[model samples]
Target: MNTNPFKFGTVVDDEFFTNRKEEIGKIHSILSSENHLILISPRRYGKTSLISKAIKALERPYIFLDLQLITNIEDFTSQLLQKTLKYYPFEKIKHFFKSFRIIPNISLNPLSNEVDFSFNPTMSSSVILEDALNLIEKLSTKEKKIVVIFDEFQEINKIDKNLDKKLRAILQHHKMVNYVMLGSQESLMKEIFEKKKSPFYHFGYLMQLDKIPYEEFFDFLTERFEKIKNNGSGLSKEILEFTKLHPYYTQQLAFNVWENLIKNNSEDIKEVILNSVITHDNDYERLWGLLNKTEMKIIIALAYERKSPLTDEIRTKYMLGASSTVFSSLKKLIQNGFVVKINSSYEIEDPFFKEWLLMRRAN
Candidate 1:
């Protein structure tokens, strides 16, 4: 049986999971303590997988709730309670949840044999939230501490402005549960945890997941590619070189390259890049139609090896108009996750978008 050695577009785990030894170690160590964790990474950079790996290594019962799926405060409480029911026995926690002032409406999914929870929407949200959160402490024994992971936690404020204050107040008093909160949006996560006025400020140990170092990523790709072809390491370097070790795009490009090698018996990345561009052509077209003219100019300039888009040289060459206008456009791009601010330079978040821009210009 042959399966593609490279994978992307989902949580890469086990063999497909790339190198994040230090990160996993840090997360695992924090999970072992009473302190909570706040992990921030750009979308698809493998923060979820890192947390999954750490929890598996720790060999503890865990509950995962993605706040992105949460529609409101009631849904948040129900989702957390649902995952809790799956991890802990119903009978053990039945009395605890049943005693709530407003009892949760529980049902069993016959196909999956998992429980679902819902509460009366008419009840106060904060009280419902407190009851759901208390399940963490109730289910834990002295020896076995549970891990509750919240992914895309930046959505808390959107559910209700003061939900953060309420959640922080409840979570601070828990003794038997260790929380690991993960968020994708850099700016929002920063504001929620880094700002002085935010209730969640400094509530946990902060960590930012970064691009996999080139040295480690290069070796990872080379090892897998070599098994598929002789001296595949040389060819594999092109994937990293083109991706610049961006975690998600590196896997995406490698997936396409692996497909090219299997079907066409070639290591050439050029054809793969072109085919990828063609595959996403319509999406790029729509994106281009939506982008502001100033943004279009900046993207072109960056694609042309012109770094520091704010600089006078780039502004002059790209006809980017006033510096402040360029700054405002770039900020918009960054806020929308289209552009990433790296140190003193700015880069398009999607590597394929950058390639498509350059390719369109060439034609």
Candidate 2:
């Protein structure tokens, strides 16, 4: 039996990773120059995978922190300190604690053989954040370059409004550390980094990740399916079109197809698609519940047309009510990640959701 080669809902290593050659090279070059980078994409566009691949190509010391897992400033500072100490040399760690005037008791996890440092909780959040910044600066003074990756960095906005300003102030002067801030929320990331009034304005080279090219993805799927000796003929194209080349969904659909193919030699792509939607029915139902009626109509219109909903004919046909309502609903959907603005048009972010909506309309 061939093991399923597709990976979804997690970061895939180079073995299963398909493309992004240009992105990897560009990111590597940016880090090599000790420059900061801001990578933006909608969720599941493989921002994390691209970063992980790029980091593997680099020879520098690096730390990757997922801000989504961090709830507040205290969590951020503690994780920052812990990851820093974990990656830095033991002697340098000792120097770090001494220089920062912080004492942490060290413990080792027997199962993972991982060392963890726990510091006293006497310091304020601001103080801890400042000290963490200081630690990065001090570490940068060493000969080796260090790279720091903040994944889902827009989550910082949830922790504190001033956190961006404070981080920018400290990071602006760091000479030795290169930073890559990855965010899946396009609007928020742009506001944080592109808006002139924001503290992180022009903070780094801004790069937006687009969906994987159709040809590239198709070739990858075809090759992997063939390697497993599975008769995946015509399935790759179907999966790509159905998933709209969204990385996560493509992998997920492909995974289901592979499983069905193995179990029953079933090549019914549409069945796999239906099963996938049905599996996530509850989550989709909850997502639908979150939107108001106007928003729902806009999404339905977009799902049906897959074009600009602001057009007169589309508005009339969908009974989108009024121009102002359409505009507000579209804005809300885009901001809330239910819809995405593609080139010259808008699309439902989740292709399966689009399918589900179409099925509902037909019913």
Candidate 3:
């Protein structure tokens, strides 16, 4: 069987990745100039992939850290130390330990051939954080330029109330390091970067990633599938429209369609969509159960509405209560990743979830 070209739920490299030329260029330019950047986008919109691609093209020494797995301040410090050591050379590592005034306890694991580093139990979180920041600063001085990316950077807010404040204080002075803070949680990311009261207010250039352009996506799909069969342009366009050109879902739906085409060579798009929905039925059902009644009602209303939900007529037709209630529910939905506000209109972020809601309402 041929390998599925479409990639979902992970960082896709060159072959699986489609167009983001403009995004890559902008990020490169920002980092090359020694400027920090904050990348904001909804879940599954390819922010991680874009970061990975840009890092490869940068051809510079860098470290990529995913803050999603970091639960506390200690984890943040340990991860920073570990990832930095992993990316830098052994001579640089020795230099870093000697140059920093305060060093974390380091140990070597004999069986796994891995080094473990952590702060002393007697030290406070603030002290450990200071040591980690100092290490980064010293390391940056050794290299000409270094890039560090903290994926899901918003998680730091949950780790500690003052973590962002502490980070901003140290990171603002680094002369040779470029920081890329990436987050899928739009509201929290904005709170950190956009709000004037926040510690990272205007900390870096803010870039919001949107869906891939339809023409670029369609061409990529056609070229990939055309090798198997000559006539895939129509089907490629159909898939793009159906998925609304969402990066993750478009790839997921195409994976299913490609499988079906391999088996029968005559697969219908609608049937493939149904199969895809069925495959994700349990996940969709569990997602539905997580929402409150008001959220559920609003999502169902959006699934059926042909116009913007912000209109008074649509609000009345859906019996969506007062403007305040609607706004509150919308906020909750957005924070939980169920909805996204695009310019003047709110949309169900997941197209499959919207279809699933429509099916539930019909029954």
Instruction: Say which candidate scores most in lDDT.
Output: 1
TM-score attained by model 3: 0.95
* TM-score to native of every candidate shown: 0.95, 0.93, 0.95
The residue-by-residue lDDT of candidate 3 on 226-297, one tens digit each, is 878788898898998888888999999899889888988766988888776777899999999998877887
Q: What is the C-alpha lDDT of each candidate?
A: 0.85, 0.83, 0.84
Q: Which ten residues in a row have the lowest lDDT in candidate 3?
A: 87-96
For each candidate, how many residue pairs have backbone atoms clashing (under 3 Å)? 0, 0, 0
lDDT of 3 at 122: 72
lDDT of 1 by residue, 1-363 (tens): 457878888887888987689998898788778889999877777888888888888888888988888788898888888877766778777888666877878888899888877777588989888988887778886677888898999888888878899999999899899888899888889999999998888989999888898888888888888777888778768787788788889988988888888888987898898889899999999988888889888888878864687888889988999999999998888777788876657888888888999888888
* lDDT for each residue of candidate 2 in 63-172, tens digit (9 for 90 to 100): 89998898778778777776776667566566666656455556776887666655567756676687787787777645677888999988877788788888888888
Candidate 1 runs further than 4 Å off: none
lDDT of 1 at 33: 80
**lDDT (0-100) at residue 266 of candidate 1?**
83
Give the lDDT of residue 16 in candidate 1: 91
Residue 120 error, candidate 2, Å: 6.0
